[model samples]
Target: MQIAIRADSSKIIGTGHIMRCMTLAHALKNEGYFVTFYSRAHEGNLNNWLANQGMDVRIIPAGSNSIDQYSTAHGSWLGATQAEDIQATLNIINTVPDLWIVDHYGLDHVWHKAMATRSQVMVIDDLADRRYDACLLLDQNLGRKESDYAQLTNAKILAGVDYTLLRPEFIEQRQKASIRQGIKNIVISMGGVDLQNVSGIAFRTLLNSHLHELESITVVLGHANPHRADMQLLASQATHIQVEVVQGVSNMAEYFARADLCIGAAGATSWERCAVGLPTVLVQLAANQQIAAQQLTKVGAALSLDIGQLESHLEPVVKELANNSDKLMGMSRLAFSLIDAEGTTRVVKEIKSLFA
Candidate 1:
């Protein structure tokens, strides 16, 4: 069996889609099926990173056609129109790759309908706004349901947190979930592309606060972050504290297990935190993230905030959570309860059954 994944990662377009798709792709690949990726060369796109995974990838040219009209809120990120994207994808796959798993906001039901003529379709989406012509639809967000996608396609829906697409590494490492008494050894990982440098803001707040109980702080940055130097400077200024700045991490599960408190963006990494039972101070980086962040917080799984509020209120919030060990434990329990860590296996079974 063969599958062709359509997803992109870059500075403007965060890596969440590609990362989750990679998780599913890796799992499917392990089952002896061939998988390939078709991505456009957007500025910070994960083309290179995908190549490093020893996977077959074909990059669409790094430019856009003249198409200003778009239907979805994030469609501008596509860099090309729906027709152009389909043409670009078809140009490479002269013989359709059995199944097309698309993870993009720009290409809606129109794009899916166009591609449906060639092969079966599965869409990975969290935004319940657009329409789709898919056979299977997966939305791993906390509050997602079949009704949310009622207006869209008549696809076989895989909804809610149980189907969260976590990588095998995260699943394996989550067996050693962290047990937290109080907030210590803080890990600040505000989105991979922290254009606002929210991690630096949190770092400074922690340094300035009276929270001396924190033994160490680990700040995670991605290759696309321009504020890497600023984070290093922040670490240097914290003479009384031990600080580690890790970039392009391959072992995220280990960090989550070791962390007592996590200040991370409300993206694909939310499930990773919950898998390791890490109580997080979630920041919504984009409009798409608000639902997951708020839903997680509503269920007592996490604490969500905006960048401005994160800077203004993070100190007090962290202090309160740190001093109250009971609250931390409760939150950790709720967070862990939100995910089973077997999402990869569940999703793979669903995919395989599609062919069977």
Candidate 2:
């Protein structure tokens, strides 16, 4: 079977879409299916990184035109009009794929319908604001309900965190994870591309805080992050705390397993932390992240904050959790209960069943 995945990553769109799509593609490939990625050459795109993972990648040349004004809320993220993207994608593939999986916020029903005529259409989405035309639709956010898409599409909906597309390593780490107690070690991951340098700000706040138990701090940065040098400079100045700046981490599961607390963005990484039962102070970096962050907080799975609250609330939240081991334990249990880390397996099974 041949599968074509349409997903993109750039400074504006972030890497969560492509990362989750890559997880699904890897699972499909393991089942003896040929998977190819169709991406655009956006500045800071992950086409090269996708190829480095041994997947067949076809890059559509970046267009010079501005995004259509009438496109979706994230239309500017596409770097081109929806019609142009549809044609460029059609011009690349030689044969129709058995399944065409799209995970982009910029493309909506128009693109989905255009692709559905040529292949079985599937969509990986979080926001339900737009319409879609697909055979299957997956939304892995905690608060998402099937009713949200009732007026939008007739596609079979796979909703909630149960269908979260996590990598295999997270499952392994979860099984081997130990009970987390007080916050001694911390990990800060503000997203793949921290355009606002939230990681550095969080690190600085921790340094000035009164957390005597903080032994070490691990800061994870993406390869596309332009603030890498600035982050490294901040880490170098940390005299008391043992700060380790790791770039482009492949072993995030291990880091989550070892850390007592995580200060990161409330994006897809929220699910990864939950997989390892790592308590976190989630900061909402984008508007789309608000729902997940608020839901996580309401469920006791995490403590939520906005970008503006990081300076004032971050340290106090971390200190309160560190001081109260019982609170930390409860959050870990709730976080672990939110996701089982078998999402990729279940999703892959569903996709294969489409052909069977």
Candidate 3:
């Protein structure tokens, strides 16, 4: 089988779409299918990283008509229009792949219909906000239901956290994660592009604060982060806090495995944290993430805070979790129970079932 995925990542659009699609691409490739990506050459895009993974990444040059279909706020974030995009994509390909995976929000039924004549369509969505013409629709978010997408599309629906599409690393690392204890090691990950520099706010608040039980702190910044220098300087000042700013890390699951606690955006990585059973202080980087934070908090899997409230509430929240070891342990168990870390495998099985 041959799979071609159309997803974009940029400073404004963030990295969730391309990152999740990469999981499905990897799964298909591992199952002996040829998979390729068609990503826009947007600033802060991960086209290089996609290529580094040994996948053929066709870069679509971004221009005025470019777009990111999922984004209602920044509809033109893709740097091209829906018509321009599909035309550019078709121009570059030798032949259409067996399956066409559409993972963007900006393009909808109209866009999907245009591509329908080319190949079978599979949609990977989280918001369930728009209509799609799909052969398979997977929304792996917690609390999602077939009904949420019932009106939008009649595609075969795979909904909820049980089918969270995570990389194989997370599942393997979850098995090796240490038993829970007092929160000492803290990992701060603020999405792929922390354009607002929330990572700086988090670092200053924690390292310079009165909370002293923290043994070590690792802040993972994305390659797209414009403020890596700022993060590095803050880490240097926190000599007593055991802080380090890192980027381009391929082993995220390993970090989650060793860390006692995590402070991160409630994006796609939320599922990865849950898979690894890491207690989290979830921050809502975007409006879309609010529901994930809410659902995780509702189940005692994580503690949620809005970005506006982060500076004021982060210390108190971290301190409270630190003082209460049993609660942290319970949170770990709940996080672990939310998903079995077999999301990609399950998704792969279902994809194959379509052929069967």
lDDT (C-alpha, whole model) for all candidates: 0.86, 0.90, 0.85
**Candidate 2 overall lDDT versus native:** 0.90
Q: Between the candidate structures 2 and 3, which one is better when assessed by TM-score? A: 2
Compared with the true structure, model 3 gives a TM-score of: 0.96
**What is candidate 2's TM-score against the reference?**
0.98
Pairs of colliding residues, candidate 1 = 10-44
Off by over 4 Å in 3: 66-74
How well is each residue in 102-125 modelled by candidate 1, as lDDT tens digits? 999877888888988878999999
Kindly report which residue stretches of model 1 are placed more than 4 angstroms away from their true locations once superposed: 68-70
Q: Which candidate do you rate higher for TM-score, 1 or 2? A: 2
> What's the lDDT for candidate 1?
0.86
TM for every model, in the order presented, reads 0.97, 0.98, 0.96
lDDT per residue as tens, model 3, 262-337: 9999999999998888999988888788789899999999998877887889999998988988999999999999
Best by TM-score: 2
